[model samples]
Target chain A: MSERALVIERLNKIFTTPNERVVALREIDLQVKQGEFITVIGPSGCGKSTLLKIVAGLDVEYDGKVELNGQQIKGPSLEKGFIFQEPRLFPWLTVEKNIAGDQSLKDPKVRGKVHELIRLVKLEGFEKAYPKELSGGMAQRVSIARALLRKPDILLLDEPFGALDAFTRSHMQEVLLNIWETNKTTMIFVTHDLDEAVFLGQRVVIMNPRPGHIKSVLPIELSFPRKRSSLAFQEMRRTVLNEFEKVEEESYTVGAGI
Target chain B: MTVEISEKLSEPQKKKINWLNVTYPWIVPIVIVIAWQLVGSLGFVEEHILPTPSKILTTFGTLLGNGELFYHLTVSGQRVLLGFALGVGVGVLLGVMTGFSRLAQEVIDPSLQMLRTVPLLALIPLFILWFGVGEFGKVFMISIGAFFPVYVNFFLGIRLVDQKLIEVSEILQFSFWGKLTKVIIPSALPNILLGIRLALGTSWLVLVVGEMMGTSAGIGYMIQDARAYAQTDIVFVGLVMFALLGKCSDSLVYAIERKSLKWRDTFKG
Candidate 1:
């Protein structure tokens, strides 16, 4: 359980256009032990999504290296699953078929796994429904199920429930925590929400933007089935919020170079 | 629900509903027909130039009784169907090819665009010269007319499929064929169906013009033949048949679209 599952060393990324170049990430270093739940909290341009993309092997045009299970990631593989802010479910396919994806699970035994996933996601009754027929939360659940179908060692989610309503977003966070507890898959969840970071992550990586670097790593000591109304939860959230403000002020001052 | 709504209506509202649902549609046709009948009976208009509705109906009955109308209709219908099938097949195939391959688009798109811009009806002269007054000539003309709309619509449909959906396919590690069949085609289907609907109309229009040249047994020929003898009633009957056929084929395409797109959560009411 203590074995390192992912390693990122001095990761840097830049977006080059015809007229100018914008640095998106700079000197981002991260490490994750097996089955660890890590949340990345940052402002909009803090490169949280970019960091996740690099780890998922979706963006390979970076300066540093990313390794999963001691092997360098060259491109996307079934070993790691990636989920975007949008569900991105195929509208033309039924819910079950969308989760089944390319139907690469040709083994008759593997077909049953889709049903298991449907049950796991608590979407058993709506397996035949299309994406458009689903509510926002249900659709994101389908996206989660699709990413989990291959049983990836690591799941990279970029603001998966960001588009959901406040109630649905909190509910989905608890659902995600339950899944993480049961599946024991390493998860790197990225979000801009302070409470979500404190509530979900074993360690929340607070990031500040300008060039995008990690500012602090805060470990949450709360137990599972955590109550949001509890004093400890409020304290944790306040602590994270205060750290967030300090980082923002520091970045503002540093950016102004005064 | 209907009873409650009806009960709520005032006298004026009731009258409005009656006018809108039952009486409004018939007003224009009734006025036109009565005016036409009066003009014909009073000799205010020449019979040869403007036949009354009754005269047209009488010509329609005569044509139906003699089986001439059915023969011409079936001939025209056959040409439209054959040309429509060939055009749709070729258009969809090329659309998929160009959509999936940059090389195919680079090589084929320019020529297709140039061909599409030339008025399809204007090519009737060239078609007659090449195919020489045969069934093939008319069918070929109809095929050309049907092809461009389907090709252009499908190509755009394929292009407009959301990028996020394709990214999911990449993350899933789908093979090239898997992406094409599962993601590409299904996503592009609504537009493809629209293309087919549009193609059907073009097929009917081109079939009429194609039949005008070197054809003896079609609705287009019937209208042309009647024009020489000033049989205005027969020409009216031919025009009616064209409208009916066009409507029937359009409904057929709509039915297909409804069946294939049942998964869509579009507005039903």
Candidate 2:
């Protein structure tokens, strides 16, 4: 709905554990244009989660600024919706209730919008079901529906389908792509899956290990409805894999550590 | 793919349950009662001191005809109901506060913990001295017994709410009270119900002990009065009534738990 959707300026994050001080993110700079779909891929503990947290406003102790449509993020707000790795549905609520949980849905029109989001995520008949009855992928689908119901400018996803099996994971990726195409919301997804990054992201940002910072940004020029078997897609994957290998060789942290 | 087909196939069927869930419980209780009757008939024990099932039932019928049993039952039930309601209500309110706020938890948790250390029955003399061996004293003891389990459960339930759900609530701009009522309370529900169950049991027990020393009515008083008249069958009736009431209340709570968590049972393995 607005131009220049999100901008992250030189973000820095440090974690103080009881016995150790670990740098989670350092000097991160990024820009996500309106309707842009950006996926981040790296080794585990590369501060991908930390970056998403900073954008989602869950962690504010970091340095630098995160803005959505020129407004600075003071804390977590309805302007940006987050889908965590775990579905995290309240066990007491039904699936429909879970998806419609955000405060903005207090509006009657927003209630109608939640039904649309549920259909978008392909959970049309599951409104009455509970999270416990659903499989891992199904619960995560409800979570995505929940996030989209807020109608945020940007959708921040931290590997929403990471816990699912491979086939379920692929199906979810397609669902995610379909949602992106229809809504055109700027989505910043953090994942460790290289193939996932190549398939869904318009541009894939690769980060080096902890005290994580972006090492390279690889543009995925392949068009949507991207065929996994396409030679162009395969070639792009090969190139990205080569670059990732290089970063892994030079990584300094355990996850990104060479 | 194999998964593509199954993904659309709906949920997998769970294994069939065994007969133990229903028939065996009923059978075991019946067998135990029959054996006790047989043993008593065979002169295995003195009938006057240890009344048989039939003798107890006969005494129960006589007591019922005289309204003696109903009077004690009514008195004990009233105390349990009052104490249980008061204890659970206060425990839940305090528990919610402690769970949500560090400062409140810091102030109240220590005193509540200390209060739990003093056995509730031990306070009978103090209660009599304060309230003059009356209905208030009996109700107070039951309330004390119910408080701890309810409080502990409420506290644990609140603490156990998933951190990510809280994050979701925060991002949505839910106010503190909104989060407490909508998110935190619902998330903590299963555990809270568990606390209520434990408190119910504790309250039942305290009702018996509370009436044992201080009251002239209730099952405890009935048993004490029967002892004076050597009406061992009447005492047996009181014991049987206590057992039945306790059993029925626990079963009621269990049923409630099942009804509330029905969705969970279907969804989870």
The window of 10 residues in a row where model 2 chain B has the poorest summed lDDT is B5-14
Every candidate's TM-score, chain A alone: 0.95, 0.92
Candidate 2 lDDT over residue span B1-269, tens digit each? 43554444345335467677778779978998899898888999888778789988888898899998898899889999999999999999999899989999999999999988987778878888899878887887788788889999999999998887787788877788778777887778788888988998999888877777856889998888888898888888988898899889889988887776665655444
Over 4 Å off in model 2, which ranges? A16-23, A102-111, A252-258, B1-22, B40-46, B175-178, B265-269
Q: How do the residues A75-117 of candidate 2 rate in per-residue lDDT, one tens digit apiece?
A: 7888788998998887777777887773445677877887788
lDDT of 2 at B52: 83
- Candidate 1 local Cα displacement, residue B68, angstroms: 3.3
lDDT of 2: 0.85
Which residue pairs show collisions in model 1? none
DockQ for every prediction shown: 0.36, 0.44
Tell me how candidate 1 scores on lDDT. 0.87
Question: Would you give the TM-score of chain B in model 2?
Answer: 0.87
Tens digit of per-residue lDDT, candidate 1, span A18-69: 9988788989888999999999998878889888988888888999878999
Superposed on all Cα atoms, model 2 deviates from the true structure by an RMSD in Å of 4.0
